[model samples]
Target: MAKVNKRLAVLVGCNYPNTQYELHGCINDVVAMKDLLVKRFGFDPTNIELLTDASAVTGEGSSSVVLPTGENIKAALSKMVSQAEAGDVLYFHYSGHGTRIPKPAHIFGHDEAIVPCDFNLITDVDFRQLVNQLPKGASFTILSDSCHSGGLIDKEKEQIGPSTYRAASSLSYKAKNIPFESILEHLTTLTGINTSDIGTHLLESFGANASLKFLTPQLESELFDFLKADEGILLSGCQADETSADMNPMESGGKAYGSFSNAVQ
Candidate 1:
């Protein structure tokens, strides 16, 4: 008998449509990965949940398209983890914008995050928490196809350079990250709230859409416990200081896609 497919996945693709932070290929990346998982990995169709922006005009995930909001993404991951047993395989693939934050208290000396469509910052702390909840012998692999994706799992060992987000020494592509301050500025323009405190403004504008990591800092001990979970694996697109390029239609044979995500596919 064929082995049962003991796999689950939460795929997220945020293009931030009609906004200044618009991306061209994130959704394409997600769709391609879904296809790869279904055909090659044989993950049950019912076991794969998709979250994307605007339901994807391509109609790939239109049947049950969940928006890539911060809460929805977190909840989906929670649900996947809750259903997993020992030795099961879990995967999270994020194709969107990513930004870095200055958090001296974090084990990494900073925080890396993927930018949900709503701009709620899901930090490394949150990913660590997710991994910690996984049952022993389970594996949660994360492929982040966005800028500053390095260190997304808090204490994961580094395999690349430019330890923090900064100007890449030399890159020819545009980074899918808005400076953290610029995100605040954008919110200010729309919400008419001007403050250096990102958590405050995000709470005001996006409300519950904002990430809890910004609102409530997890205790150091709790964070330590989260990091101690060794089942998490990270496939970051680039070093924190470097940018990941999203190929536009012109560059990708008339189909837009994230460069890193395409390579993985």
Candidate 2:
């Protein structure tokens, strides 16, 4: 067994406040996960980077808080991976909406992605690239609590999310989902460039902030570029075709939370 040396983490939660994509429980999810990592797992608070909505995580501390934008999130991941070595363990947890490409799938089946607060997508190809960069003996684990997140790691099959056999519930439930059409509409409205090509819209609007994986499709050489074993792990909330839920449980006094995240905790 590999003797783990240091434990590092990045926790992201995006509520997208006041927008049509607004969620109610992601902030709470990251905060709770932070506490769990500190108390239950052995993660140093200083070594972990927490990203979420500004208004939600206020009064938590005086540390420099970063918003969960695509650029910022990617930067955080890169920073953590850059510092890792053999026997080190890294963890990433995302609580937010997820999406998938409806046409010309990048990886052949579906190109799943996580929708950052700014709507700049971080796709499975991006995650694959990040994983390929990990140093040997370094283990990176991802826990994604978002809709259509199962394929966030290219060709991942660890599907575990919502089920049709869900017990009856009267409380409100919000799907942590942003359809391709909605994303296109939002981008078109922002850039005034009506095009079905999401990559073009993202490139026009966010530029460098947009995920390069989407902007530039991963090449065949790149796919075979980093072939290693046991360096990366993905624990997604649902299959590529499924949608997770942000739900208000009856026993929680009406405070909403992610169904998948809640179950995980």
Candidate 3:
């Protein structure tokens, strides 16, 4: 294989329209990132793929681009990674809703997943799998501006954080844990898949951190093992246990945007 020196980016933003979890700033965040990549990083404009609920028009006369579905996003990522050779740089940026999903039956920890426009989650396990496919000397970096994104690349060591979020004295942010059960229910509702393995769900609920636990060796594997990847790094918006904010700040003149994404831009 030819060792090609290329820089590729896949930027995804989702403002879930007509839904209870609607936000106003995700697409804007990706657009700003694209501009930064082109003007500052010297990334070729044609090499970037913009996927968002809103239209992306590269030039005045260019046609508006349609949003990507979950399958489309997966296919793009697969192609991006599969095409990489040594000395390639792959960038993935996501500004959207994120949540925790119970790891599939065989894996022990919970999965941190990005919520796609279609509600089909792309989990950290998926990302790790992709990173594993990267050729030697290739690198993947991800910036996830979403909730529960800390471990978004699976077993990678957290070099920057587990940092605490401290807003000004007047502003307060509280973190809440949504039960994994609810996520399973949402998945089932959306795709009619039987996500509930009742026996395993009950066992996982008993606190994986508990000292006195009754679980078989197989169950133990579900709590402590993860796929390790050496080629990817994740910069997440919040600690795994915290929630990222979708801010509608006054400075933006009444526009909603992801606070982390705005800061990065």
Candidate 4:
């Protein structure tokens, strides 16, 4: 008989303050996952961690922590990777909004980003970079309940502000101010439909990296190889163009599971 291994789970959900933009219902998903893992998978509660917006203020659970900003997220991920041990299973869940930024000169060489919150956004390259850093021989599974989260797409044209216009124009002349609505329309035309391909592509790219090593036979070659290169599994909530819905109405106080969460439960 094959040996059974211990697992570590990290659950996260975010609802940005002052905005109803976060419709993914990540908190409920995390909670549901926590219950399912305990009830069905027989995972110890002590092995799991949860991070969320409210938790940032309340400071709950041993494994559960809160991320107040983008910097906090970076630090948390770094800590999580550092804490991982070989031969252990790691489950990570993230539910929130994804945004695109103007690609920088480094990786992918195009402007794209995933909207994280008010102050932070995660680019495709940035996310791939993080995934590449995971330890070997560990089973890492990730569920991202968000959209348009795929690979780098040019967002330079989508940027607005006097400084951007001036930089692009090279001070040729003070042109009449352009409307943001017009720019958005232009961006839509240029990018067509922004899909979740960016996220999948990033995962694929990471999985393709040559340095990955796999330790389990049950793991399929393609999926394993891809993840070894990238080192994780991401079960996204929907396709690139689709939006993940909140099962509960905003006014309701009772917690509810998202479609993916409900299915998992």
Clashing pairs in 2: none
Cα distance off (Å), candidate 4, residue 26: 2.5
TM-score of each: 0.86, 0.89, 0.77, 0.57
Query: What total of clashing residue pairs does each candidate reach?
Result: 0, 0, 2, 25
Candidate ranking under TM-score, highest first, comes to 2, 1, 3, 4
lDDT, candidate 1, 117-197, per-residue tens:
877778887887788888888899999999989878877787665546444423234568878877778768767865777
Candidate 1 residue spans exceeding 4 A from truth: 1-5, 57-61, 104-109, 160-173, 206-209, 218-221, 225-229, 251-253
Candidate 3 C-alpha error for residue 133, in Å: 0.8
lDDT of 3 by residue, 84-178 (tens): 88888899988888877654554655667777776555666667668777888899989998888898876678887666557662222222233
**What ranking emerges by lDDT with the best candidate at the front?**
2, 1, 3, 4
Tell how far residue 235 is off in model 1, in angstroms.
0.3
The TM-score measured for candidate 2 stands at 0.89
* Higher-TM-score candidate of 1 and 2: 2
Worst 10 residues of 2 by lDDT: 55-64
On a 0 to 1 TM-score scale, where does candidate 1 land against the true structure?
Answer: 0.86
Give the CA lDDT, 0 to 100, for residue 73 in model 1.
94
Higher-scoring candidate on lDDT, 1 or 4: 1
Q: 23-130 in candidate 2: lDDT tens per residue?
A: 888887888888788888878888888999755542245443689999999999999999998889999999999998765644556678999988889988888878
The better candidate by TM-score, 3 or 4, is: 3
